[model samples]
Target: MDVVKPKNQRSKRALEKRAPKLIENPKTAMFVRGGHISQIVTDVMTDLCKLKRPNAVLYRKKNATRPFEDPTTIEFFSQKSDASLFMYGSHNKKRPHNIVFGRMFDHHLLDMIELGVEQYKPMSSFTSIKSSVGIKPCLIFSGDSFETEPNYAKLKNLLIDFFHGSDVERVDLSSLETVITFTVSDGKIFMRVYHIALKKSGTRTPRVELEEMGPSLDLVLRRTHIASSELFKLATRRPKALKPKKEKNISKDPFGSKLARIHMTRQDMKQLKTRRVKGLKRKRDTAQEEGEGTESSPKRQN
Candidate 1:
């Protein structure tokens, strides 16, 4: 006979059921050029946080670089722990440079739930990914020495096209005095505008300065959309209707054998007519000769 297991042993086994598993969080970083700092920072917060509006703390650095550095004149940082930030290196003596732009996620919390940072993070947390204003932002440069209007327009169009979405309303362009503005609908989102004046003469590119302005992210997104109705109308307006190709009768000669055939038909008709006339003439001559021969023979017999 087999011995029965103890109740305490069974209870212990039940209590020892496997513990739920936990996941590890992810870490990532991104570096953006100085010229692109404002744009990238806006994208990251909007894409990561899903916030209607987000803000960052801006700080100007002094004596941060090497020798001969000026006070409060080295670099600047726009920081938001929940959102990504941008860092630009500014120097009075040297060229200002854009250093880095990046974001850090709460990896530990996300990993414990076995989820990716994307799953736990909202889009608004990312700077560049924020919802666009209904109206598109325009870029402008000011200079009396050089005409950069054409280049600026082309760059503006490219940027608009690059950042535009299906929901955007319209894009407006304008310039007044020294300051340029891109007025967006429902303005509340943090947008940094950077301006740079170049030290070199006859240079189209400018030195850099950064500032934040804008409406809410939703409005920004609406401004970015390219209306489908307008696009459809444009497509239909200038249709390129293809010309219908003539089906070649390869059964006949390409050089027009029809014309040659017509000439041959005319020649055949003439030949047939001539033959008929000649036969009629020959029959009449034979009849006349026979009549004359018979009359002459009767006369001789008589």
Candidate 2:
């Protein structure tokens, strides 16, 4: 005798079992290359740190090793509790300037959970992950267009502010193409812009790719990377409307003094007087009752 099975039930069971296995072993991982990639990752990681209730780790490799080789992995991992939005950064010497950004299918940090390691353990509760990845800092700029000298200078200043040091040696510009690349140290972070242009014809809005970079950074430079974003023209546009000045004769009454005055007319005063009279009458009645009770009470025996 043969047992009959429903096709959909079997499919669902198979998927449930296979999903975990796939997550346990991810097939495709992000890869970063070039000298500025490390800095890009650093900047991105810095921003990730700003998230609330976040678990982030940053680590550098002790010994240099080849890419995809054992003992050569440097990585950063970040996750929120019970969330399937884990962000990972992986790097190695073979890809010295190469960095990889990845997300767990479930974003639950199941790899650590499976290993029985608590999220961001052994470090301060506020500490990000301590990975073996080395640091490479670089300047990143985004704007509507870096084509003009002034615009380029503005972008340069923004980058200078972002990296903070003269260590930024390579500059990658993809603003015109709505893309940005920053390479510093041994890592790189790439950003793709998405939004309205700040300028009518020369500005752009930017969207920081949080998941694309492996880690979070303190400061990430996301300029208006569009060709015509309002912010792009903000540096050049005239104000459409000026704020009105306060009138010297106008009183600053938050409680609407005019309305209050209107409500405090003679009729209102009469009603208030009536309320006070009633309140006093009630008080007098209470006093008279207390006096009568005192008089009626028998004198205490000596």
Residues 205-251 of candidate 1: C-alpha lDDT, one tens digit per residue: 54333323222222121111122455435522532344345545433
Provide the lDDT at 109 for model 2: 18
Candidate 1: C-alpha lDDT: 0.29
Q: Model 2: per-residue lDDT, tens digit, 1-302?
A: 89545479876775554443311321222222222334444443344332212233333322243222321132322222222222233233433322222223233211110000011111222232322222223335544344344434444544333223223346443222112243322122233222112234344744433212223222222222222344335433444354456554456478777322223435554346444454567777889988999999999998
| RMSD values, in order shown | 23.3, 22.2
Clashes of each: 56, 52
Instruction: Give the runs in model 2 whose Cα sits over 4 Å from its true position.
Output: 1-40, 47-80, 105-190, 194-302
TM value for model 2: 0.20
The window of 10 residues in a row where model 2 has the poorest summed lDDT is 113-122
- Candidate 1 — which residues are off by over 4 angstroms? 1-133, 138-141, 144-154, 163-302
